[model samples]
Target: MPKQLIIRGVPDAIARDGWWLASDATLPQHEPPSPTFPILGEAMKRRMPWIASVVFLVALGDLLFWGYVPGVSLVIFAWAIFAVACASRPPKRRVIAPALLLVLASLPMVEHAQLLSFGFLTAGLLVSVAWLRIAPSRGVEVLGAAALRLSASLPVAGVKGVLNCARAVSHERANGALPAWFSAGYLMRNWAFPIGGSLVLTVLLVNANPVFERAIVQAFQIDIDLFSLMRRVLLWVGLGLLVWPFLIVQAPKAAMVVTPPKTGIKLGLNAGSVLRALVMFNLFLAVQSAMDVSILFGGASLPDGMSHASYAHRGAYPLLITAMLAGAFALAARPFLAEHRALKPLVLLWLAQNVLLTGSAAMRLELYIDVYGLTYLRIYALIWMGLVALGLIMVAWQVLRECSARWLLIRSAIWGAGALYVCAFINFAGLIAADILTRATDPTVETQTDWHYLCSLGPAASKSIAQGTWPKLQIATPFWATNCLNPQPVAMNWREWDFRTGRINGYLAVDAKMRAVRDEDPVGR
Candidate 1:
């Protein structure tokens, strides 16, 4: 017999293959069937209002506080999460973790480049909290579920919520009593023809007589910018659309779907094959590590054909990419090879070597920067290398503990993305210029400064470039040619303000003014 459910006081046939009846149902008055998904039906019902309220409250606070004080916005966001915790009534311990992370991650929003990083980290936390509220005891699955929910929620939830609302409205209109204003047929019958006729008559009369058209234009000569009006409407509507689903419903539950294995392979790999691969991979990494240690660290001179800086620069990027691949392979392959006792130690040892390799990559990049001078990419590469190293360590821990590789990956990806996003907003050109200028003043240090690169750091470094005295006149020419010193000022609202831009513009304005005064009065200088 097909699975049967009483939907809307009638027995409905639900398909046998895990298909569910999604209709509204009423149980007996004496005792209702306990919710199969209590986290969704009950926990969310209790917590969603709080979550939604906090979301709007934070938005309001952002409007009021952001860019006014660099630190204040972070505090307000934290408190908004706190208020959410109180309203949801989750345990203090559970609420504290995500709340703390949100506040800390939000600190970087004071800088512009960190916005994507902040979005990813905060999205992860919000998803995690929503999952925890529904199913707090799922252990390792919580992290995976949170990852799944976050990945799914962004693109799927809003559309689903919209459909849900439409369905609700349709059902209510069809089955329940409706007010006259909401009845579509009644409205069309009563008002549609009259409104249409009025508009038609008005257009015809305006075209028929020049005098009437002039009178109408003068009477309705209000200053209305349609573009501005449309933009405001879209802004609030877009925000509402983005947040509506989250407010009305809970995120996907851990139970809604099964978590797949890291590799997704059901069949076993041969113990011999895995062992052979690990051994070969380890030997290859060993050779590379040995070479790096010898040439880069041991003071061994490079071959005549290659300069040390050139050799170092070539490997800096590729080696880090290699280490990242190694971490990924180890995570994916470890679960399959767990039966082999020897593979575990070898895997840990391999990851440790990759960490060392990452360190070597960082050293090489530093050497490259020392020779070529700093650019934004070089500085960010160093930061990324650090995160890659940390990720490798986490991968090793996952193997040692036999924890879920998926969990390790999810957490690592969150942090790595956050790091890169945060790095994006840094004023690298200004920083490089400042550092180079400081170093050039020193008589002891010997290094080439790339003034051309400094000038390319955009208007942010305008002040440093305009005022700096350089060794090469060629480098100084571009600064004058570009007129970077007096780039037009842009007025930023509180939402768009950030530390880097604020400081850059502030310094540039002051320095440009000073330069102007000094030029006008050389004797005073």
Candidate 2:
């Protein structure tokens, strides 16, 4: 009985020891295993497909864009591919919808690759990337932040990509032996020597005999443009850097922290300060407005020494700056508007004056344009003035409704973007050309149109130039006609061909045929 009890007790003792060993109280604690290469660790392994896609896209970009001017279709397709690749799995409809809109915005580039079109495309890309990565509820808030992050990432993305790739290869090597051909040591030893030696021997043989050199040249038939090669390589590097950030899509670790507003700080801005500023600002602006009304709208003659052109030129841009400054002051004074009843009305009056001031600036620009003829810059100025006027009105609305700064920012961005989007598609070059041509043809107009400036607007203005009924002696088959109508060194491939270029080409062909028929039939001329 004693022996049996001892055996049972021994089993019980063993069980108790095992339970204690496995229990939290007795278990030995251990830290997680450290990653050999943190950048190319398990998390990065899951993202291998993304990195691979980036590499593929970079190569595709080279194939599509290298040695060519990319068309709108190519631009859209490339951006779509990038956007799709970087998008989260099972893409949300909200995200897809906006991305599609952005991609479609590239359509304007199909007509003519203007700076406005380029800007829209660039903004679209940045916004798309931002949406994919951050998915901010409001785009206006994140747009600047995303742009800043992207700019910061661009410098280091390439180097980081290279290091990650190297680590990935090493990681794979550690997992198992790679094929001999794929191994770096194998490549350096077996492939490099033979290729290098063969090149050296081939060069020696070529120089040794003219017949050998001719044979080598004929057999190989390799023609390399050094400049072209350099350009392609640079494109690869630049494009790789640009695309890598979208692939990684690292969100900031923490939300942007806003510092709490200080209670004790006073910057001398109060109801009184705002009232004083508004009073003085209104008086100053009123004086300017009275002068503008007299000179521009009232058609009063200029002062003794000031020509109309001089007056218009001097005030056009400065008044615009002044209006912008007035808008800024109004925005800054919003906090004080509710403090004083008079402040709100005064602010509205100020904004109203600013709008009128913006209009006067526009009139000034118009007068200048009337004298000097329209150009791209003047068109932009006109558009900007319109925006400024609208913005001032929105500022007044904000003050009246007590709208948040965010509300104002979002609407302002929308208006500005909408205006730019519209401008992107408009044929401003053609408009400028037509306007200048119309003004030049007027019998009473003294200023001569700058034909060289018109020509510099490129093929977009070609149609207007070709269709214009010029004075008989003014221009007889202008030399710029051939240059604009038949742009030399035509697009090398469809990737470079745009709708605008194609239309121009088609028109040229038709025009040539018509001219030929007309030449044959003297009565038609």
lDDT of each: 0.65, 0.73
Question: 1-525 in candidate 1: lDDT tens per residue?
Answer: 998866574333443332334365444257786533322333335445744674585466546553353333443444454455445543433555555655555555655434454564456446544543554465434555555555557566756665765665565556543344566888999999999999999999999999999999999999998987786556555544544433443434445443444555734556677677789989998999888888976878888899778998899999899899998778656755667889888888889999998999999888887666677778879988999899999988888887774578578877876676656566667688776665555556577555556556666666565455432233323345454434544466654566766776787677667767877996994
> How many Å off is the CA of 371 in candidate 1?
2.1
- Candidate 1 — which residues are off by over 4 angstroms? 1-101, 113-125, 128-151, 167-176, 188-216, 222-237, 251-269, 273-286, 297-301, 329-349, 395-426, 435-456, 459-475, 479-481, 485-489
Off by over 4 Å in 2: 1-48, 83-95, 129-152, 168-221, 250-268, 469-492
Please state the error at residue 117 of candidate 1 in Å.
4.4
Most lDDT-accurate candidate:
2
Q: Candidate 1 local accuracy as lDDT?
A: 0.65
lDDT of 2 by residue, 257-358 (tens): 323245775568889999998999899989999988887768788889998888989999998999999898887788777788899989999999999989
- How many steric overlaps are in each model, in order? 0, 0
lDDT (C-alpha) at residue 288 in model 1 = 92
TM-score of each: 0.65, 0.76
